[model samples]
Target: MHEARSASVPVETRAADYLQAASMTAPLLGSGSQETPAVNTYNSACGELTVLLRSSEGGRLWNHPVTLTGNNSTYHLRLEPASHAVWTPNYFTSFELEQQIKEKLIRKENIHKGVGGALVGVRKVNPPEKFAPPRGITAAVTATLDFHGKDATLALRRPAKQPTATVEGKTRPLAANFSAPMSYYQPPGNLMFVGLLGGFNATKYPAPTGLYFMQPYDPDRIPLVFVHGLFSTPFTWVQTINGLQADPEIRKHYQFWIFAYPTGNPILYSALRLREELAKADQLYPNHKPYIVVGHSMGGMLTN
Candidate 1:
């Protein structure tokens, strides 16, 4: 006998306290059916709280293809954006620094155009790897004006926690896909070569440049900057960051940053440039918390 292949998504099993949409009243398929459980949408406190994600150029994403990934849970994912991750300085554009190092900046995300697409999450059960549920309605709405405020719209652009919505007063854990925003800034495969080339050709690739941010800046959280050694980029810190971020205390109190420099360059020049970048960042974003710099290899000398 062949082992049955399971493709069940982990959904809330508790009593359904929330009102279900009339359309959802249709009887669920029988146990042996091949169909997957459909995405459940219920009435929210806002009557119908919905997520409306779109491209910056005003294109529709409803019909676009998506993939699924996660362990013990199903996450709907779209890899097109991730595959096209950038390596340029302005992976985003326009911060106050261009106009004046003197300008007081609240946060850089306010100046960012946004990274990529959203991660769709499934509750735990099936592997987060390639778990796609099928059959859903699609429609588009045109409005005279958007109802979301500046903060809401801005938050939507930033990489966020599991994509979730509160229905009534209860918070439900929906299926969640991963958020890999840093990958959007610089593709890992190219970092090593870039760091190496930058050392030899100072003109082609400069050292100790653009302060890369992984998230929106907050005055409440202290900044923790990571400096990588020769022939390396912040990509080296991935596992370390993954572990640290797993800690709630670290996540609450610290914001991560990276300083990229040409490793092959003279130590002093690289150090000088690091200092200049830090000073400029301080002038623009004067936070109450002291800066925390961590360095590895040659990056250690400069951090000091």
Candidate 2:
């Protein structure tokens, strides 16, 4: 006999409550034909709730952190084959939860036998805390996809396009993937932090000079370069870039970039460095799109 595998996900509060309520209606499945009692575990010691189902022989089945969907009272859960479990809410009475599991098992067997094309790149799992959404999108929508076949092709199904806007006497598709404001600025290193606070000389402590992209660089689009003032890192442009990204027109046409340098550097020297970086980028991409440079505090002089 094959041992059952398990998959665990963090159960969100709303889904957890719905699961607990549904479990009271029916017990979970176990090995053989016996039905196993449903036990809800709440870890008050750590102020956490643990919801899981076990088989009749005391083997574990479905773990919490599963996805639940439906209206207030009706809920349906979908778990991976490892857990080998299925659940139905109190409303799905004609087919009891146990019967539903049996049907699901049959379906799984059919799937494993190559019944239908596999649904690849369909992500229901959430990412780690460091990687959250609405901040920045690094990859194209298709980047989330994975495939076992080289011949596999992805079809992007999108809703109807939104209205368009007129630019330069021509109507164009509006750029509409706008996200809520995120703080992309804010000096990341201790050196930059101390430079802002006090005790800083460019000669003594040279700030690494480089062109940093605040967003993914699109060569086809115009560039909007932001230069921060004395004692401030690229983080000084955080709010400014946020404002620009929030605007639909600006987001559609320009990519945001920031220049970071030790604040103690002389204005002329810093500006020379900025000019060199800009020239380098132009040579690399060779796109003649418009360039918009904005400067803050002493940065205003660099812009000149």
Candidate 3:
């Protein structure tokens, strides 16, 4: 509420619109919040959510890429069904890390990239009036596979700007996850252990000493860099990042990034590293929006 009234937040309007559209669209999709539970599976049968996720270390979401997810989608259809994904949040220290390595360790995909999910509708193609529905695969089919990934992201951000989909001859708001990539991003680690590890041995579990994006780097949205304190790693801010992004206002306008450095290093050296990284980013993304750097504890000194 406070942000909506504040003019300084550049994304207030778009964020407000997304929230409004979501409220109106959720009930229609039959995937309402905990408070407004789905009436029954029958209602949700009209639509089903397929989360598209990238493979984690030593694991893959599937054996191979299947139809309806990647480049195979057809845009001419208007209602393109897309795949959905999730990155489960895992910030708490995994006690196992301390046992095997006997050292606080940060284990992540290391490489952050890949597709999100999609919400598609599946309904009976043949009318129910047909008392004698045909067996086999003739009774029901995938009614529509609307939008997915980035395509869905833009539509929900500014609902009015894009064309609405017609489902069952009725216009409907394109269903999508308001917060992509971030909402599903789950980085597994013990923050305290990893932080101390980095602070103790710069080389063993060193953090990338540059601007690392939590999501795809959006040129339009301003960059918000989070720096962790002494004996801390970017994992320290995972929950904080998740919470901030839950709000449409912040998610729409500001892309989150992190400045990770081995806390064991001298503060002056780390600050210089940050300055150099910012300069490089500016060069790469010319005419980009101003940046907002946030620091905690020792991180505060680096920002200053």
Tell me the tens digit of each residue's lDDT in model 3 across 1-304: 2332244643323233222333234334432212222222211222221111111222132223322222222111122323222111111101011011211222221111111112211112245211111110110011122233223311101211221344323454333332223323334455567778788887777445666655434477888889889987776776676567555567557777778788998899999998988888888777879999999999999999
For residues 39-139, could you state the per-residue lDDT of candidate 1 as single tens digits? 22221100111122222223232224322122322223221221111111112221111112221211121111111112221111234111111111101
RMSD of each: 16.8, 18.8, 18.5
Task: State residue 261's C-alpha deviation in candidate 1, in Å.
Answer: 0.9
For residues 93-202, could you state the per-residue lDDT of candidate 2 as single tens digits?
11111111222101122111100111111111235121112223221110001112211111111101112322113433221122211222123357456565422656
User: Once model 2 is optimally superposed onto the true structure by TM-score, how far is the C-alpha of residue 7 displaced, in angstroms?
Assistant: 5.5
Whole-model lDDT values for every prediction = 0.38, 0.37, 0.42
Which runs in model 1 stand beyond 4 Å of their true positions?
1-53, 56-165, 174-179, 186-190, 206-208
Question: How many pairs of residues collide in model 1?
Answer: 12
Candidate 3: RMSD to truth: 18.5
Alpha carbon lDDT at 303, candidate 3: 91
- Runs off by more than 4 Å, candidate 2: 1-192, 197-199, 203-207
Model 1 lDDT at residue 181: 30
Candidate 1 vs candidate 3, lDDT winner: 3
The candidate that achieves the highest lDDT relative to the unseen native structure: 3
